[model samples]
Target: MNERRKLLLHEKVEVRQLEEGLGGSWHPGIVIGVSESCRKVRYDELLCDTGKSKLIESIPVTGAIEGLYQRPFVKSNYRGRIRPRPPSPEHFDVKTSLSFGVCVDVLFKEAWWEGVIFDYNEGGDERCVFFPDEGDERKFKLTDIRATLEWDEFSGHWRERGVWTLVSLAKEHKKEGHIFQLVKRIWSRLKVHYGFMKMISEWTCGAYCLW
Candidate 1:
């Protein structure tokens, strides 16, 4: 048997975004993956709200590299005004909206345990117990999470450019309900994009690299 190879901290992280969505409809925004060492990457989906309608906006994935070993997380704030629709004499229903945002320090960690052993007794025999060590485990943590909205523009697609600053972990709180809601919405969108069967096929073989 070959010994398991340990991966470098940075080598264990991955980030990717959903390829579909009209900027604001909750597409895959950011995905971060980590390995046992704590190396991580964040992939964010950026949306620009052009003056045009929300349906015609383009959202793109932006890449950011973060290393916790370098420094502590910082906080950032962003503000902007957006016209949900193009200005027109007939478009009296259009409204101007102001967006305020903040981004704070986010942290991630991962760990794994391999080849753990267990012991057991057979036939009521006190000495008949043995265990083998074999398995792997992983974990991830995000802290000081925040984001700020800067300026929003609408051309053919929606675009929002902003400055992201890390914040203090003291202000962070876990919102499992909100997280679950967002995840549910994203999964709904994914199901619509790819039907049940196709989604299963792609998830098992294509997107997740299960095959």
Candidate 2:
């Protein structure tokens, strides 16, 4: 039997982004794994708008702005503060006495919003169903709900809060202009270019090491 190697795992941390010796941004991240050398750490990277978790490594722990996982806000230029995606099943508690067709308040940015149970699954918790929209009532995992909202009739927002406004959305569909199409082309090219660079980086490192 072999003894396990020691690893430094950070529960909550902020990763600072530095580019071109100019701009800097902080991103929420958690150290999930450590490299065999103990020189690098693999972490759950949280992105703005959509809470996308991506693994980033081969960097020193000093690169991260140490902090708590409680920081859920990601600064954005277009939408200001975009809430990151909810934590995985590990971090959420999904027990509820509320039943199907019951009105509930969904959690968003520390506030409760309207949400309705679409369908109750046989398996409770982590599999609770919520249908906030009518025509597009989609069944979601129990972990998706923020919390159950209590009925308040006296509030002025009874009608508005009774149902989620974001679900029943109204928007105009305008044809994409030439600028939009051009932006898409540039974006695709940038992706290919960055991907090529990443491939080269991995290949260069792999060539120098035998392990």
Residue 147: error of model 1 in Å?
2.9
Candidate achieving the largest lDDT: 2
lDDT of each: 0.22, 0.34
lDDT of 2 by residue, 1-211 (tens): 1122222465443333333321122344555555543233333443334456455644442111222223334312111111123344355444544454344544333222334554435356643333222112334445446443221111201111132221112112223334323323433453356653454311111121211
Q: Please, what are the lDDT tens digits per residue for candidate 1 over residues 1-211?
A: 1122221222321222223321111222222333333322332333246633312222221111221223223212111111122222243332222111121112222211111011112122122111011111122121211121121221222232221111111114433335323333443455345454343422111122211
- Residue 144 accuracy (lDDT) in model 2: 43
What TM-score number comes out for model 1? 0.15
Scored by TM-score, the top model is 2
Instruction: Record all residue pairs in model 2 with backbone atoms less than 3 Å apart, i.e. clashing.
Output: 105-149, 126-142, 127-142, 128-142
Number of colliding residue pairs in model 2: 4
Q: Which ten residues in a row have the lowest lDDT in candidate 2?
A: 75-84
